[model samples]
Target: MFSNLSMGALGLTADLPTAIDLAAKHGFGGVDPDLGYLSGLGGTSAVSEFASSVSEKGLRWGMAGLPINVTAPGTEFAQQLAELPAKLEVLNAAGVTAVGTWVRPMHDELPYRRNWALHASRLSLIAELLADSGIRLGLEYIGPKTFWSTERFPFIHSLGEALELIVEVGAPNIGLILDSYHWYTAGESADDLEGLSDADIVSADINDARDDRERDEQQDLDRRLPGATGVIDLDGFMSALRAAGYDGPVKVEPFMKSLAEQPVDDVLADVSARLAKAIG
Candidate 1:
């Protein structure tokens, strides 16, 4: 497995070029570039230029934002689907292997089963679109119980449930973008990871949580850097991924506001050291 850094997680508002440069300088082997930034650049030439810059810094491109929205219905959704081919072409040229999006309960007004079916149908279509490009779609399960309570339809919040949804989608390119924070909140054990095949996972995020809060009580913004706290068993998490044959990038996605307030270099160095120790 390799270490990757996400600019959003770091709370660094740097543009793509600066983010890539920081990622390489701070010991990250890969980076999850901002999709918004990439979109703003526009066209295949811009993507190629970004790819060249990443290569020049010796950094690999990890996952990027999803190129299309699969769940939205109607003309807006149709437009997103229509634009997918060109967007994917740019990503393919840039050597991006996967793209990811979060799956949460957005339609609380609908019954859970109905909403799930709708999401499944849409995702299957997306998976089909991405499969032709040899790109995988990574779906992140939102695990917090509070997140579910606020949703119109309580969505799948567990890794097991997410896997079930992926199976129902029945696409070869669809997989989980496993996050340690969600794993902990969902009450999943290391054994859960061991039960999965490498193909079931497209990528992963590594971060710890505050020990002061209860598991279900932990908020998204309450994250700590990996190894900064003992609320999550990160070493065992990595071991389980290895056991399951996952050799992909594991990104540090600590959402701590405090870390974001610190110097970028200091935060990056600290994160690198912590990740190395945990991965070791």
Candidate 2:
């Protein structure tokens, strides 16, 4: 496992201090910052200050999630290309190691194989752009309304398909970002987790899945906390990670009202405890 497992930005209200505090308290080695939250802290100028805070707290530098649409057509494409260099500079200033993003062609617009290729080629460009900065690019398998290269069709999803594409790009700076919820939503079994390579494992998220049926919002399987009564075979999943040789950083990623409402410390304490039991 990554000696530096970190919390996503939901913990700190984007406050570097709270993030620093919680991470230190919980033995977390780093944090995966949501850039939107970071902007709310003090905008781009705060990067240096934030980096200093992290260093003081003794946290390894992690990624600042970047917002870019690599597959957008026309001038929008130019916009992403133009803005990325500046964004990368900001991330580098913050001592970030990876740049994670979401990109998938609209399902109706591109054939799966072709979309996969184009996306891969574009990632190669991003890899080249960040080559000297030591920042890498990662693509997450998105939920509905986005295009994806998945093993289960019509049910479409998975970073599994992107693995080969990253190899084709052949840049050390490109890889995949993944979450258990997405893998479950795509109907991927624990067996699917066996194929990851460390170079391809830049980002990781944790969540649980239950029935999709609309409930009093209490049973909304799509956004439950880990250990919440659900059916995400985490033991099997972790086994697959070990099988895949992915001893990388992991993040506790509960994304619902209950978990999100709790104080950061309380939430993380719960996550850290559950993760201990889950991983064991």
Best by lDDT: 1
lDDT string, candidate 1, 107-213, tens digits? 65778788788888888878888999999999998777767777666778888888899989999899999999999999988988877888888889988898898
Please identify model 2 stretches exceeding 4 Å from their true place.
2-12, 34-49, 143-156, 211-221
TM-score of each: 0.94, 0.77
Model 2: lDDT of residue 158: 53
Q: Clashing pairs in model 2?
A: none
Quote model 2's TM-score: 0.77
Per-residue lDDT of 219-269 in model 2, one digit per residue for the tens? Answer: 212466666756666777777777777765666665565655767678777
| lDDT, residue 270, model 1 | 85
lDDT of all predictions, in order shown?
0.82, 0.64
For model 2, what is the alpha-carbon lDDT of residue 20? Answer: 63
At residue 194, what lDDT does model 2 achieve?
69
Candidate 1 residue spans exceeding 4 A from truth: 39-42
